[model samples]
Target: MNSGAKDRPSTSFSGVIRQNFATKISLCLLMALTIVVGANYGWRRGLLVVVGGLLGVALYYSSFGFTSAWRLLVFERRGAGVQAQLVMLAIAVTLFFPLLAVGEVFGQSLQGFVNPVSVTVALGAFLFGIGMQLAGGCASGTLFSVGGGDSRTLLTLFSFITGATVVTFHLPWWKTLPNLGAISLVDQFGWIVALALSLCVFTALFVLVGKFSTRETRSLVDDGPVDWLRSPWPLLWGAVALALLNATVLVLSGRPWGITGAFSKWGGHALHAVGIDLSSYPYWAEYDFGRSLLGDVPTTTSLGIILGAVASAGLLGKFNPTLRISKRGAITAIVGGLMMGYGGRLAFGCNIGALFGGIASGSLHGWLWLVCGFVGSIFGVFLRKQLGDGPYRNTQPQVEAAKP
Candidate 1:
């Protein structure tokens, strides 16, 4: 009987039990938090939190990363990630154009994150590109990666917050710099024309990248059987999910999805807690900073993203947290985080808020951001090489489907 018991594969059973238990706990926590947020805030805010969680799950399962996408494109001439981004942007603009043209939905007035195409945007986005390469993640990347148990990103987040806070003192001066002001393609050309123009650009980029990239084009669908609950999702799945989620956020919140503003808010509150007076700052005074510090959509959604990522990781049986940063890696993380935080604020947003939200909404600044940020990323890749980091390293070979 003991010999038979030894052959029963109890270890596999225990592993299943553990995975199930972790999944259950994650779900329960998510449900409880949702209820709490609903009870304290409103149902709308609570729903946004749930959306944030799903964003995390989508981000985690797909391992979708803007940072790696840019680096791979620059270093290895691989464009799979870039292609996925194009798909996401195309989907986003399609959904956004008609809705924005209407101006109002469900009694809520809609607004795009259109900002000035200024020197500030160029400088900020350029710096942000370099930060992306150094930090190994962008704003959304850092948050989701932290939620996925990457301990190094934790340090990056802290430094990011610090950098964002420190930059607020100088933002007023940056604003004084030359700017072309806001340019909305939607407003200028009407939604129909804007949509067609945006789609043409996306198609052109898709074709051009496909032609030049060294990697062979691969199917977005996973070849292996995918367990929706536990297995990794295909890149296209992540792209579609993100685009839809952003649309949902716009419908619910009356504005496009944003991430970095919450970081600024958090940093502001932290400084206030330490006896610093922020009311004097023009940037802080322009809004209901006190009310925002209490709670807001961006804050709740950001929290939800982290929780959702944790749940996603737990469900996947990959929630092993480790603080294994080498000295060089640690330096880069801090420096990168600081640059990202500062650059994000200066540029009016990070990848999600500025590039994704801006472009989808037909803001010209979004296009400017793309050009400047990509240029900056080139220099960043060079810097990474100088620092002795493997800028061309490919962590996920299957995703790239590289040519021999």
Candidate 2:
């Protein structure tokens, strides 16, 4: 431990200050941006940006990840991460159901992210699952990880943007595909029944998955004192914070939290800048793509997430950026990112927008996303093994021995 310390700066007051330089810088930038947003956009939008920031902080501090959680469950049979997700879903659905049922809150009309159960959705979600494993992160995961200075994910993000944009050219074809249309559980059944059913599903998943974990393992949730200022947060805290923040988003934005929509928007803007006309595309025309950049809630909130992640990484003294990626890793990241971006668009969203937000909003499509995505993830795990990626490649199946 002493040797490790010697390899880096000391943990004294001055050293601590030195380590947090990035944190201070990120906070200042975040504040300036927030002020700008508040001045131009409404205070409500500004507040949403803050909520996005808090989400980023929670995500980074807890290292709460959808991609790795699925991979761990598929490859190692470790279900703790997936279990934490269940807890998050449980909390979110509880809050979302009643609010969605109300329909109107503080003069804001509320709605869930219900989308069609279609062939496109099924294939898209499966591809997204595979992309996440290969790229090493999901939509939110990609944003936060890139913001936290994982340079490799930067490559992935660029590819993601490109892929999302490329798919717009093919959207007309996909729309022609058979779609069952949107199904909202809250609308179909009463909110009470929807909530009960959601809870039961969550409970069933929790129990069924728990049986696979024969030994205790460290997970996002930790059982001990946590230094909120700098240390990693307990996963449970992250889960609750995410749930509450998502609920707050629904109240403020009239919809639950989403991330990938902004990615597509950004991609559109980039293409437009390059003198490409996408306005003729049905998808872009439908959304009125001529709007000013960052004029929407999703874009601003997504930006906030990245900045917030940067701040969190700074606070934790982990904001080291590097572009040192292996050739194979780079190839995989690009390919995976493209798949995630394209698939997410087809599926109507990524893990956050589709799975978390969808389910919490009582959308049947969310459940479909979960099932299909997990199946894709199982294949992804094997693919990763074939690519020589890590423990999945070398390690044999065995329970971790209990530590003495």
lDDT of 2 by residue, 148-249 (tens): 888779989999888887887898899889988899999999999999998998999999989987544556557777899678887788889999999999
Can you tell me which runs of candidate 2 are displaced by over 4 Å? Answer: 1-18, 219-221, 286-290, 395-404
Candidates' lDDT values, in order? Answer: 0.82, 0.82
Worst 10 residues of 2 by lDDT: 395-404
Tens digits of per-residue lDDT for model 1, 1-404 = 01222112224666557555656776677778778778877777678889998999999888888887777676667787889999999999999999999988988788989999999999999999998888888899898888867888998899888888888889989999999999999999999999999999999999898787886333456788888885779889999999999999998888999988888888988888788878888888765545644257777778778888877877776665677778888888899889988998898888999999999999999888888888887888678657865343344344332311
lDDT of 1 at 24: 72
lDDT of 1 at 124: 91
Clashing pairs in 1: none
Residue pair clashes in candidate 2? none
TM-score of each: 0.90, 0.92
Model 1 weakest 10-residue run by lDDT: 1-10
